[model samples]
Each structure stands twice: as structure tokens, then as C-alpha cells.
Target: MQKSILWVFIALLAVSCNQTTKKEGLTTEADKTEKIVTATINELLASPADYQDKEVAISGMVSHVCRHGGQKCFLVAEDGETQIRIVPGGEIDEFKVEMEGSTIAFKGIFRVLNAEQTEEHVEDHESKEHHDVEQSHSTAEKAEYFVEAIEFKDITP
Candidate 1:
């Protein structure tokens, strides 16, 4: 009976040690260890190729979130000429519409759209009106690079 009690105590202690404590903000040990390169949304878009396939960090105000489920988010800077799509992964589950206008810092790897994705993006744009069609064509020309986020934390004031 004493041995059973001792074993239960050991098991409880092991579980507690493995558990992760949630802090007010989402800052993991991995985030701290990564080479987080802080840049604005515009900077990233301006030199997408330079940051391609490399881990980068960017901070921007969220302009939109996927209405259906918040699986994706659009980040924009002051210039607003370009935007970066944030594909939430790892610790990030979804982005809420309420998060709009809130500043967020994201750490992730940048990737460029493949030929198939570019074709599909253009096709989607072609479905809209003539003006939107032209804009979509331009978006297609831009290569549609995006970031695959591993971590994101709100920095709204």
C-alpha cells in the first residue's frame, strides 16, 4: 500500500514537470532562441526574395482575418502598398477579426508561390470585375510570397 502511494506521487510529479505554463503572452523558449529579424511589413514585401526560405520576424497591424475560421491573416504597414499573408502554424491556432488594428509580431519562414499557386491566384482574380481582374493580374505578377508563422504575439498598444 505504501509503495502504491509512492508510485502515484512520482507519476504526479512527472506530469507536472512536463506541463507547459501559459503566460499572459505567447513567448516560447524556441522563439527566444530563434534568430528573430524584426522588420516591417513593407520591408519584407519590398525584398521578398532576399528573405525567401529564411526565418524572419515582422511586426504589423492586422488588416483582415479569414471570416470563415480565422485560419489566415493579412498584415499591413503604414505604406499599405503591399501586404503579407500570415499562415498561422505551430502555436498559433487562428486569428480573430477583433485582432484587426492590433499590432502583432510574427516569426516565421518566408516562401514564394509556386507556378501552380500563381496560376490559381490569377484565375481567382480573373473571376472578379475588370478592375479587380487587373489588380489580381498585378498580384500574380508580384509572385505572391507569404510567411508561414511559427509564433505570433500581440503588441497592440
Candidate 2:
């Protein structure tokens, strides 16, 4: 009877070991592939080699959502070197609701550059300056989520 129990335990251990090996192999294969979606700031930064000097896509909450110049606003979060900038325009009310200390989600191409290429100029690693919503915005177009081909969606929970 003891021998049978020992055999069962050994079988279980072997099965678990095999599963672990399979999981490790899958993770190894994933390291060679490209990732597009980032759930958090840490995960995004973990793979900087893929977006050191390129554009990538990501989504996250608007940690620092503030409007500048009265009309334009930017969401600031740690996106692999403050490269995460998005100004949501569509669904204004919904977006506002999110900006009110709520969670928001944005889906846009990230320009993971050391410098940001603005509409007419390039700003490099600025310390996240926010504008006044009522004073900075004039046209509905300013509500856009991106400046030079960047955009986002509201993420509410």
C-alpha cells in the first residue's frame, strides 16, 4: 500500500514539473515576439528594447489629467519615459467623467522618443505641464487625444 502511494506522489511531481517546463518554454518564445498592449507602467518599461526609438500602442488610466491653455489637456503616466501623452476628445462628457479622478483608458500609437514632435515644434522630456481647460481650448478639434497622430479612449470602471 505504501509503495502505491509513493508512486502516485512521484507521478504528480512529474506532471507538475512537465507543466512548469511547458510554461517556461512558452515564456521563452514570447520573449522573441513583439508586444503591443501594456497593462501597467512597470510592464511597459520592462521591455524598452522594443520601443526605444519607435512608436508603440498602450492603454492606461489618466493619472494626471489636466487641461492646458483652456482647451487642450494631457494625460500623464509613466509610459516608458513620460512618452505616454493622450488628449481624449471624442465623447466629451464621458471623458470628463473619467478625468474627474476616475480611471480612463486610451488606445493610441505612442511615440517612444526622447523628444516629442509637436504640431510645429519638438519638446524633449518636459516636466508634464498641464493647461487650463476653459482657457486653452477653442475648437472641438482640440479635444483630440493626440497631437501628432496620438489618440485615446476613456476607461471607466
Q: What is the TM-score of each candidate against the true structure?
A: 0.66, 0.36
lDDT string, candidate 2, 5-97, tens digits:
999999999999999999778757754774555444344445645444333455545444343422333444444223244443323322343
Alpha-carbon deviation at 54 in model 1, angstroms: 1.3
lDDT against the true structure, each candidate: 0.72, 0.43
Best by lDDT: 1
Q: What is the overall TM-score of model 1 with all chains considered together?
A: 0.66
What lDDT score goes with residue 106 in model 2? 50
> What would the per-residue lDDT of candidate 1 be over residues 27-83, giving only the tens digit for each residue?
665656777667776777788787878888888788777665777677776676566
